[model samples]
Structures are given as structure tokens and as C-alpha cells.
Target chain A: MNPATHRHPASYRDPAGFVFEEDGILYRQIHPRYQPSYEQLKQSGLYDRLVSEKLLIPHEEISQPNTADAFRIIRPQRIRPVIPPFCWTYNMLLDAAIATLRIQTIALQHGMILKDAHPSNIQFIGASPILIDTLSFETWIKTKPWIAYRQYCESFLLPLVIGHHGVPDSPKLLRAWPGGIPLETGRTMLPLRSKLSLHWLLHLHLHARQSRQGDTPKSSSTGFSSGQMKNLIHSLKLGTTRCHAGNKHSGWTNYEQQVSARGQYTSHKLAVIQKESAALSGIDTILDLGSNTGNYSNALRNISEKIIQLESDPQTANALYEKNKTAGDQNSLSLCLNVEDLLPAGCDHGLIPSLKSDLVLCLGLLHHLTYRNYIPLPDVLNLLAQLTNKYLWIEYIDPTDPLIREHFNPERVEQRLIDLETFEKQLETLFTTRYHTQLADSSRRLYLCSKK
Target chain B: MIHLLYLDPGNGSYLAQVIIASILGVVFYFRNLLYVVRDFFYRLLGKKDRSADS
Candidate 1:
């Protein structure tokens, strides 16, 4: 490995190639073993067709890496602020699964097979999820059923089934359980009647039973025709589409809808954001931390070229994703996870934590971190300073905000109330206040600050 | 050429897909054939089956 090249930790699972970045440009180095598959993918015209259909990310063959193990190094087009599978809502996950199956079917027609169906392989470039792993395809063998049948089940089918039963955290659950959701785990999660359904009986219930019994009495590889493969994929598609009941969450779903009904209090905040953002030019990226319902995200969309929203609630993120899809917003990236849980202990974060932006938005979130999360006010500002490259639009709600009383810690909440003057003094340590104001008829104060 | 290291396609699951797909393949094969036949008749009768291309 090159000293400057940092291999992505999650990329080690796939043997064909691994993604690494050198000087901030992402590259996928194809191993010598995967060269044949790569050649077949190109010569067979499968790569071209898939790229033309926009199902696969297009890449250019760059100069080979400076390593003996490397056969080819290609630069795949970048997807900003990659959102993981755990953050995806049921609908987004299902859509990704369907897209995977569709790509598999396409690959089959071109005499190749999609060897893996990991949900993380798909990223939302816009409203549609696209396959980012170019080396996921391999030449089809005569009777090789699917090298990744179990992976498809554990990663997509079972997760969707669990989500269909009104479990919103199924994707997160699957991610937590390691390689994929265990068959028995998925089997137990489904209701008894699932065994009656043909799709479930084959893919989940009996599949679980088959997995536990070790070697099936049948031969390891049996006669599986191409038609049978398509039929199996079709069945998986049927299972995915059967999941339609949307999951709803308690927090902030109706926040955007009520923005107009809240009258002066909300309008004043929006007016302030509009006036400030409208004056800015050539703003490259805007990061909205703690984006609940994209209420403020929608306000800042026109001024910035790209918007990255870090939303905690899956359902809220899912709702925002669906709204973006409906409106056809191509440059929006919504990541769903806890605001403070980005880099958990003993987990993957060597790359994810590097996300920052030119202008960072921290609207209406100070009290939640201070009063509710018990995070020191200075620490929050320090973190915000790290994320913000040039400008920051943050909010500090006064002690009288009625909403602050919901924290339930009467003593703790009162002690942590960061008043207007105190907030300015602390913020001055990191950012110079270019502008500041108290919203009319509301206990909220807004600040537009730039780094000193 | 197969790599020295490749993803472990669980033996049980690989065998199960063949075993189960063999049976369900017959079911869905005929099911797809029946749809084809139905679509053929619909086309002859000048009424387009909405699922003809599905």
C-alpha cells in the first residue's frame, strides 16, 4: 500500500477489489485475480449498458497503482457524504434491494452475475439508488446458483420482511449483527403465518431450517438453469414489493408541515435565514446538523450548491428523502443517525468523521445538546467550529423558550441556560459574530458568524 | 479465474437455493408461462394486459 493511500476499512470484505483514497481522490484497485472478470465486464458490454442505464457508477481506467498486487486502478465517480444502510428507512432499503435485483437481472442477460447484494453497495446519487461497486459482477458459470444467495437474503430480503412488520430499526438491527442478519434471527422475527406464504417459506423459514442442518442432503451444487435464476430473482422482487406499509415515528415528522401554521415565530426564523443565505454567493456545501424534518434545509437549498443533512431519526430522514425524491432534488444528501453517535467506540469511523462543510447550520439545537444531552456548551461550539470551514448559522434559545422546560431537569436545565451575551462571548472564542438578532415574539436568537 | 480468497458463499445456503429453486422454479416457470399465454390471448383479443411486460 502507498503511504498516502488509506484503504477503507469496510472495503476489506470484498476480495475482488478494495476502495482506497490517495490525496482525497477515491480509487478502486482491482486485484490480478479480478482482472478476468473486469475484462469480461468491459468486453461483454455489460459495463457500458449498466452505466448507460445509470444503474452503475461510471469510472475511468486510471494509471495502475504502485503495488505488485494491483492489476488495474480505476477512479469511480464520487458520491458525497455516503449514507450507510443502517440509516436508510424501510422504503429506501426496499428500493435499494429492488435496484440490486434489477441490476442482477441485467447482468444475467449479459452473461454475468452480481456476486453480492449488499445494501451498502448502493448509494443515492439523487432520488434513485445506484450501484457503486463496479467489481460486484463476475462471469456467469453454467450451474453456479448464486455465490451470494445467502448474502442477498440476510442483507435485503430478511431486513425488508422485518421492516414490513412495522419494525423501523430492522436495517440498523441487521447492521449490528455483523456479516448479515442471521437466518434464525430473521426466522424468529417473522410471524408464524409467514411460513404459509410461498416466498417466506422458501427464503426465510425453510431457508433458516436448511442453514441450521448444515449440509443439505442434496448435493452442494445442483442443476440451476438461467431461467431458474431469473425466476428466483423475480421471487425476491415480489417479496420486496410486498413490503408497502410505511413506518411512522413520533418526533418531528409534522415539524415542516406546521412551520407555516406556527405563524410569526417560524416565519421570523425563516426570514432571517433567507436574508442571510440570499446574500452569500459561491457557497459550495452547507451541513445542517440535527436536521429533524429538513425544515431549515429547504430554506437554505437555493443558496448552496450541495446540502448535507445529518438527521438522527430514521423515519424523519426517510420522510425527508421521500420529499426530496418527489421534488427531484439531485444534490441533497441526508444521513440518518444520532447527532452525537457518529464515532462510537470500537466501530468504523476513520473516514465518516471527516465530513465537514463550508457553511455549517446548527439551528434550534443548542438546548437539546446542553440541557438534554448534558454536553458542555463550549464543547458543542468547538465541534461546530471543526465542522464549519468558513461560515456558521447557529441558534441559541433563551431560558424562557417554553420548549426548554421539556428537558425535565429543573436544576440542570436552569444552570445550562446559555443566555445571549454568554453565548456571544463563548462563540467569539471560535467565530466573530458578523450578525446577530433576537427573533420577534419568540425566545430564539440567531447568529451568522465567520471564523476569525 | 477464482481468487485465492473469495466470499464464503455459505454451503448450506448455496445448496438450499438449488434445492428450493428446483421446486419453486417449476412453480414460477409455469406461472410465468401462464402469464405469457394470458398476455398472448389478451393481445389477440385486442385488450392490452397491464402486466404484460412485468
Candidate 2:
């Protein structure tokens, strides 16, 4: 078996097809059993409608099948910086549930239904959540219950309900139950107040009880009108929307408002960063470390096409996600992550999309890693250098800056270099400075450098 | 649905949704009936007619 071509780890559950990557490009191979359904998907006009509406990721037909068991192969339009479902904020997950139901609604109208409904089937591109799996649809048999009903409830409704009840780290629970939260476990975890609502009672509480009893619809009528299925899905959508994250804590979400008060300093810093970034060419991919509400990333819109904003604080990341979503800014991807975790030794870079950026912006984040995390400065620079392909735009903050004083102690800060002499000496070893400028009224400074 | 093909849709969820959806089907049936009645009255009174529930 050549190592260059291998099946995606998570694609084993479904027998219809599996995802594989060859030389870092992803493709899906449809098994011979699913050939009929794949034909119907296109011949019925469902594929075209879904693609045009942006509800599904569009794929191109590759005439050559890669394996003996495969009947067809397709290359989907890949979305970058693949984020794990466990890390999604309350609203991100909620929007995913709605998008899933919306796709099923459209599918039902086209004489088909989703054979599987799970968060794993969805991927967010910019602010929009799109279904990536093309093999999930099957003919909608009138007598058949939405065979994926149980899967949908467990996958979407249960998680949303758990988050709604303010369970601590509910999103993290997805890591344990990636195959959709176990209905029994989720039912037990839900609060008593949840039973008060009709939709919850029917979908979760009552559903779990029946499952426990092992009740099968032996002689009972299993057929309901398509209208009823649509009605049920509509109810799920309404219920899912009501489930809120409700656990936003900390001041980082409001960091931008506080920084705006120091307008003289911020304006100057942004101006220099923008001007320096504009001077550099061929910067298609950009990464911003500690992007509090993505102010700096948003300012660099004209310079780069794709911006990856990494923010550790969940509330602040959600705020940025919400802001970008509302503005319909499809060019930016905001990921909730700790900066220290990304650019360090033995860090599991497997879960995130590859971070081989052309230009990396490390503004105002170096001091925090050095002072709070106790990491050496040279190692941080080395990690940043490895992450970017060409240029690095890093900032150096002195102990006197008010922003640094908020959470860090200036008097005991011995790990960071206070003087430019040591700072430049440490920096010049890896990158040659292209331009350097000091903010108009502050001791903070920005540096634009390229790999030597 | 459970006896059908490769995917396992949980038995309890299938059973529960059957009962709820059947009840909903009845509710929509009556809703459409009411709409028909209302529309008939509107036509009789020379008022704007309404469409049946879909």
C-alpha cells in the first residue's frame, strides 16, 4: 500500500463511500452499491439545486475509479482550516443543526432523504455551514420512518439541548461521543425543565424512554405523510434555535472596545501594519495569533484573500465568528484556539487544517506567551518561523504598555527582552527586518520581517 | 425502517416519531378543513378568500 494514498480515518462508518487523500488533495470514492443513488442525485436535479443554493459542497466527476469496489470518484471543493466539532461555540453548532435540517427539507422535496445526520457531515466555510458528504441521500420510502431520525436527534438536538441547559464543556462532550451523543446519556444529562416543552418531550425525553423499552413498531403504522416529516423537522429547527451557549465568561470579548479608547495608539499601529502588509506580494494565506475579535485581521482584507484568526478565549472567538457571520464575510475563518498551543513543541497539529501560511501576523501575543506561559522567546520565534512560508509580522511590547499591565506583572517580567538591542538581536537570527515603526504615542512597536 | 438497509436509525426514536407525526398529520388535516370552511364563508360574504393549509 502506497503511503501517499490512504483512506480518511473517519470515513469508515459509511459503506456507501469513503474519503481519501492523494498527495494532500481530498477525493471521495463511491462504492458500486451506491451507483444508482448517485445517478438519481444528479438526474433528478437535486445536486444542481443544492449546489446552486450553496447548501452542499459541489464536486466534479472523475471518470476514472480509483479502486475495484468503487463505481465513481468525485473531487469536492475543499474548505480550509478544518475545525473539530468539539471546539465550535454555541452559535456555530446551532447554525449547523439548522443547516442540516434545511438540507433535508430540500432533499425530501426532491424524492430523497438523508441517510445520516451528524455534525461530522457539516463543515463551515467562512460563516456558512455546508454539508460536505454527497453520498448521504437515499430514496425517501413513504413507509419508512426518517431512518435517520434517531441519528439526527442524537447528533443535533441532544447536543444543542445539552448546551442550552448550561452544562459545562458540553461541546467537549462531542469528543467522547463523535457518533452522536448516546440518546440515553443525553436524556439523563438534560435538566428537568427541558421536559416542559412539547418538542423536547417528543424528540428527546419520550424518545429516550421508548429506546430503553426496546419498542419496535411491529404492527403499528409507521407511515406518515411527507407533510408530517416536514412539520417534525420544522419543529426541530425551532427548538434547536432556542438552545443558547450561555457560558460566555471573561473580558477578552470586549478587548476591542477597551483598545479603541486608546485611539491615538491603535490608529498608528493599524496604519503601520496595513502599510507594511500592502508592500508585500504573493501573500495568499495569512494567520493572526491572539486575534481578539479579529480587528487586525479585518483591517488586512485588501492585502490577503484568506485570513485564519486564532483566538483562545471562547467568548471573544464567538464574538468574532458572530461578527464575520453577520457581515457575510466569506474570506475569513475564525477558529477558537490558544496561541501557545499552536506554535509550540509536540503540539498535535493533526486536528487543525495545515498552517503553512504565506504571511503570519503575531501582533501583541509574544509577551503573553513569555510572561504567562514561561516559554523562552527564541523558541516562540522559531515556531512562528516554521509556521509561515515567507514573511512574519510580529510585534514587540515593552513592560510599560497598559495592555500588558492588565493581566501580566511588569516588575517580575524577567523572561522577555525590554530593550530593542536584545529584541532585534534575537529576531535578526531568523528573519531580516523589512520595515520597523513605533506607534505614535506608545512604546509598543510593529516589525515586518522576512526569512533570511 | 429499522429492518431496512445499512443505516441503523434507533428503534425507540423511530417508534416515538411515528406516534408524534401521526398526531401531527391529524392536526394538519383539521387545519386544512378549517381553512376550506373559512374560505367558503369568505366567498359567500364577498370577502377575500384564503388558501387551504399545506
Q: Return the TM-scores of chain A for each candidate in numbered order.
A: 0.91, 0.89
- When candidate 2 is compared with the true two-chain complex, its DockQ is 0.24
What does fnat come to for each candidate?
0.39, 0.37
Candidate 2's docking class is acceptable
In model 1, state the lDDT of residue B34: 92
Model 2 ranges with Cα > 4 A deviation: A1-6, A64-67, A166-170, A214-227, A245-250, A343-348, A409-422, B1-12, B20-54
Model 2 C-alpha lDDT per residue in residues A218-308, reported as the tens digit of each score: 6235666677788788777767877877767566766767777875888888888888788899988898888887888789888888888
Error of 2 at A132 (Å): 1.1
Best by DockQ: 1
Interface RMSD of 1: 6.5
Look at candidate 2 and give me any clashing residue pairs: none
Give the CAPRI class of candidate 1: acceptable
In the predicted model 1, the residue pairs found to clash are: none
Q: What is the TM-score of chain B in candidate 1?
A: 0.59
